[model samples]
Target: MLAGIVSAVLAALVFGGVAAPAQADPLPQLATIGSTLYSFGDASLCAGAIDLALEAAPHHPGHVLAHVTPRGYLGGPCGNQVKLGWVGSAGLQTRDVYVYADAAPGETITTDLWVGTGPAKVMAIAWPIRSTFAEWYLLVP
Candidate 1:
């Protein structure tokens, strides 16, 4: 009976009757500048918040920012309802800053960031409340 059940399951999968598990999309490539490594992608964190993470050299000091761009019609204005913030190691976090999207689809809204102490692992989160489509980049300078 076990063999029969296994065979049935295999047949269902082979015949496309059973749906395969969805694969998570790959994160964006990381960029390096003078020793800092920065990257951004869609992150599914706790409480349904999609966030981005940045890893920098430990013991070094640097600054970061979020360049958020909203997706929409070619000539229409994009939404201006995103919350930008960063969380660092040792439970350090910066206050959230609200930013509005630019009128152009590719135009970006820049949010300045203050990262915590070094050997640091920081996560920059961009939560869009009113926008349907958006992309963000965590930049180090």
Candidate 2:
């Protein structure tokens, strides 16, 4: 009876330490130079706030605000609301993407966003989302 009890305890202990597979998910962060008014990162919260700075960007295409590695999207904007839907292939390769923006510590640049998922069809169920407010400039690399 004692041996059985010990075995059960050992099994429980082993499983107690077992870990779950890490999921690929989006992340958000803010720069140190960010102003108090400029909104920052939040995994659970979706707050739209802007800041102020000295200069603005020309809104270039090659501009890479951030680089997503695989299977997840970073936190930021894409571009104009009209072009956001056409930027990515809508979960084409099941890869990752990092979305970032350009502005001073406290600046406001606005743009649109395109959100979707895989294990589905070529056509995204969700489409064009024009951001009501933005900082200045951003990209998804």
Q: What's each prediction's TM-score? A: 0.35, 0.20
Q: Write the per-residue lDDT of candidate 1 for residues 1-141, one digit (tens) a residue.
A: 999999999997888776666432232324332211112212321121122233332234454444444433232332333444444433455544333222333344555456543333333334433222222333332
TM-score of 2: 0.20
Show where candidate 1 strays beyond 4 Å.
1-60, 73-76, 89-91, 94-106, 119-141
lDDT value for candidate 1?
A: 0.38
Residues 1-141 of candidate 2 have per-residue lDDT tens digits of: 999999999999899879776432322222333322222333322333333221111243222122111111224332111111123324332222223332212223333233222111111111123223212222232
User: Which predicted model would earn the best lDDT?
Assistant: 1
For every model shown, the clashing-pair count is 2, 17
Which segments of candidate 2 are over 4 A away from where they belong? Answer: 23-141
